[model samples]
Target: MMLSELSRFGLDPFLKMRHMQDDMNRLLSGLGTATAQAFPPINLWLGENSVVVTAELPGLSCDDVDVTVREDTLTLQGKREPKVEGENAAWHRRERAYGSFSRSVQLPFRVDPDQVQARFADGRLEIELQRPEADRPKKIQIKAA
Candidate 1:
């Protein structure tokens, strides 16, 4: 009988391997390695005149985050503090990540730094960036032959 057929009898050898892999992944996730995903994932939208960005920051407040726009790049930097627990408390599982994180995105066009606006509410951040007048496309009139 094939090894794959053992799954039908509830004796799959691969099941043990899968459980070991999960255990290893959980143990290594706490190391804060580059393989981990970026915190506070973001969504970006580009419009004819402006760009909008929204980021999910579940445990962060406005004071913890900083937004900056320079020419064609937008940077989001923030820190999440670990929750304090009692001295006798023991942890069985911890998946949430804490510490400083910075994410920078390059915009499609140059933005007017003065026209940038940001708002943070309900653990979410929204930023609006207006394209610079000089960087916007201009319509040229066609001459009749």
Candidate 2:
């Protein structure tokens, strides 16, 4: 049936088109779920003299993750090993993700690589980066005329 004919029965063609668009969007949205689940989600805090970054690394030890800083970028690399099952065990449900993952974050300002500090505890990793002395802002003296 023609769209005009369908509209004669109190059906709005625009409303139907909107519903079809919404359905298509909902269907395609799931395609990005895998990419959206970036491993070891992180939080960043920027301060006047330093920057702090914290990441969640559950089921991973300090030796499992690697943190690096260069110029204004920070990179995190890690691997999560899958749990070993019995020889005759069968899988019922598995939701946890396992494998190697890497994420890089860009900082607002360059950091002092020599002063960078990282600490891992309780499945969480915290990194502190200090701004270089030359990169800090200095106040200028005013001369009265």
How close to the true structure is residue 93 of candidate 1, measured as C-alpha lDDT?
100
lDDT of 1 at 27: 88
Q: Lowest-scoring 10 consecutive residues by lDDT in candidate 2? A: 31-40
Q: Write the residue-wise lDDT of candidate 2 on 1-145 in tens digits.
A: 8988988898786996899999999889888575646677999999998999999998999999989999999999989999999999998998888999999999989999999999999999999999999999999999999
| Candidate 2's TM-score | 0.75
Error of 2 at 87 (Å): 2.2
* Regions more than 4 Å wrong, model 1: 1-34
